[model samples]
Target: MHLDACTIYRYSSYFIRVFTHIYWKSAEPCLILQKNPTRPIALDLQDIHKSYGSLEVLKGVSLTAYDGDVISILGSSGSGKSTLLRCINLLENPNHGRILIGNEELMLKPAKSGELQAADVKQLESLRARVGFVFQNFNLWPHKTILQNIIEGPTQVLKIKKRPSDRCRKIARSRPTSKKKDAYPANLSGGQRQRVAIARALAMQPQVLLFDEPTSALDPELVNEVLAVMRELAEEGRTMLIVTHEMRFAREVSSKVVFLHQGVVEEIGTPEQVFDNPTSERVKDFMASHRPT
Candidate 1:
């Protein structure tokens, strides 16, 4: 019996899902859900610092996002906005910091090179699965159809079964790409592709979503399409940390606006305070220059 690649992949995925489900189910009692009853913190970064060789990118940056908070991180170029977002999921590991998702701290151990590394690979993987990240560039597989791209994470990394994965795919499609489910990524427009990226992240059903300048790569006209989807997500009360240059959108949607200056938090306040009545001289200057007319 000669099995084709697709057939083999399907069977293998099924077995992996079944086995993982059973294993995790048996281990459920050992898992702890650490959450504060009064004020639940969705994501926390404490004194995060990251450097490249001699150049420091992030300098003791700290941020906290409560449940349902839409935090928009604003800054001038080279202020480590994207670096900070990437550090949340350890895509670029911070040299020193504490990161917690839902009060569960990510375990890290110092390496010989003086960099922090995940102490337990399994724990890191588990925590990473809970945080979804959307990039500036729409990172989609050119060969895969929209449906396949959306379901890939849940079915593979999450070990979700076919039925549940399909459900997730449906939800994702409904949000962003319903009309183009069967189309390959190459066939879609830039806006459509970015929406697909968002849908792909949504299909993972992450507890917290990170947007690293998601609209930066889109054309001026296409930028709003991506922003509109993001606004809907914000309205749905999803906990999101957005690193964006869209000042108007940030002013309109953010529960909290953070201004990063020279790798440190220059200011943090409500959108009204940050945009309309900023206290810091640097923040005031930034707002004055970048504020949409």
Candidate 2:
């Protein structure tokens, strides 16, 4: 018996849905009801396009992230990988596109120059608060201690009062903590800083986490510590969108992979399809070039 690609995808998707329903129902009956048992989309980007003057960065890119999905975006530099991630959280206003978070459409207005702008500032902020972004440079405040940095977003944006001991428990408990929880960024190693950055994002209790080359700045020795934390998050079924050069991590962790080349989506599918049976020549070459010698 033979099955076409579409048929195979459909079957696989159905199996996943069934498995998820059973697992969640058994693990947390209350959450399954609150999250809508059938299907709940966490994030949606429709026909996203961004241009810098005459140079188009992302062209007609669309992505949908279902609850508990980890979609990894891969490409060489200048391939618009990071730009797509930025557009999702409105850090870069897409020239033309629509965004939705959990079935709620974000309001947008057309600018005189024909670019789309958020119609309401407050609405945009509220929408952004739901999506947590982790940048390549662990953008922690230099003067703030690790604990201070972690709680800052919750205090300001989420209006969460600090309950020092409880706060520590809410964020990742297993990650390495400083002997003095108040050590500044300068005092922490690269891995520790990035882990703190992840904890900061988690403190917001976001619907989704967006990671942009999260480990690129760290020394080779420190990358694994950060990756371990990410792996733990993935296991606990966090909805994530990671733009990374860590192909091995992507292959092992992602539910879906999107390959962008020169501002267009070159290939997208499950890890097996994208990595093992890529249909695009550009993706084939890109993977080949990245292979370790």
Candidate 3:
């Protein structure tokens, strides 16, 4: 069929437009769109609440952060962002909520003897070992070398003791996390210090790591190095929950972006969907007022 030149050009342009749209939209949903996930639920927070002196912080927040998932809880300061992270690890006690880590349910309320129930304590300890938390300020012990910092949790908190076997020494010396021993917090750059912090967390062999503004304390030029390390962690399939001010990093590295406002979860979705088409007004206001600055 011989068509006029103008008609042929219009049809070709229309087809090209449709093809491009399909191609771009196919990759839209971030990493959560995988067909068959090995574990469906990793951390499920159900109807969680928090308060101080009758002032409510978290008002029935419910959400899930999955295994091998890089999730971001993004919000303005004092919006209970830090509180939520602390609640997850029981660093901050919640008033009312059911926190489930894998199959185990945590006792949010304190017990009579100032101790968790044996089974609950066991599960809490296990989850604590499995979940690692990283601070925004590089919390490396100034007195300890990188090697000591890395192994401290395993040896002390987790009660993993080691004998001086040749194999054990080899493991201690050559362990990937311990290789940073030469660098001290005072001598190392911001990025290196943060990496040491991450290594310290990783040395505990946690299934997931929580990042509390991994790059917030770095110089603008140094931010990328910390982000690169995080990207590497993501590629290695370590589950991570990041609370960051880095909108671009959140967009780039997270499988899910959660917007928190007034101690409540306002929106949760993939980066593109959340950033480009947020369903909530608070999210829209946030996305507009503060971009990457």
In order of appearance, the predictions have TM-scores of 0.83, 0.82, 0.79
After superposition, which runs of candidate 2 have C-alpha atoms over 4 Å from their true positions? 1-38, 161-180
> Residues 222-290, candidate 3, lDDT per residue (tens digit)?
777677667667756678889989887788778888889998999988887788899998899899987
RMSD of 2: 11.6
Which pairs clash inside model 3? none
Q: Which of 1 and 3 is the better model by TM-score?
A: 1
Cα-based lDDT at residue 111, candidate 2: 85
Q: What is the C-alpha lDDT profile of model 1 across 1-293, one tens digit per residue?
A: 44322333343322122111111112111111122346688999999999999989999999988887888999999999999999888899899999999979999989887778899999999988889899898889988987677667767887754564345444544442345666798887777788778777776667899999998988888887677677767767788999999988887778888999989999998887888999999998898899764
Off by over 4 Å in 1: 1-37, 163-179
lDDT by residue (tens digit), candidate 2, 128-243? 88898998999989988766776676667766443554545443244334253567889878877887788777766689999999999999987866876776577678888999
Worst 10 residues of 1 by lDDT: 18-27
Q: Model 2 lDDT vs. the true structure?
A: 0.75
Q: What total of clashing residue pairs does each candidate reach?
A: 0, 0, 0
Model 3 misses residue 266 by how many Å?
A: 0.7
Worst 10 residues of 3 by lDDT: 13-22
Whole-model Cα lDDT of every candidate shown, in order: 0.77, 0.75, 0.70
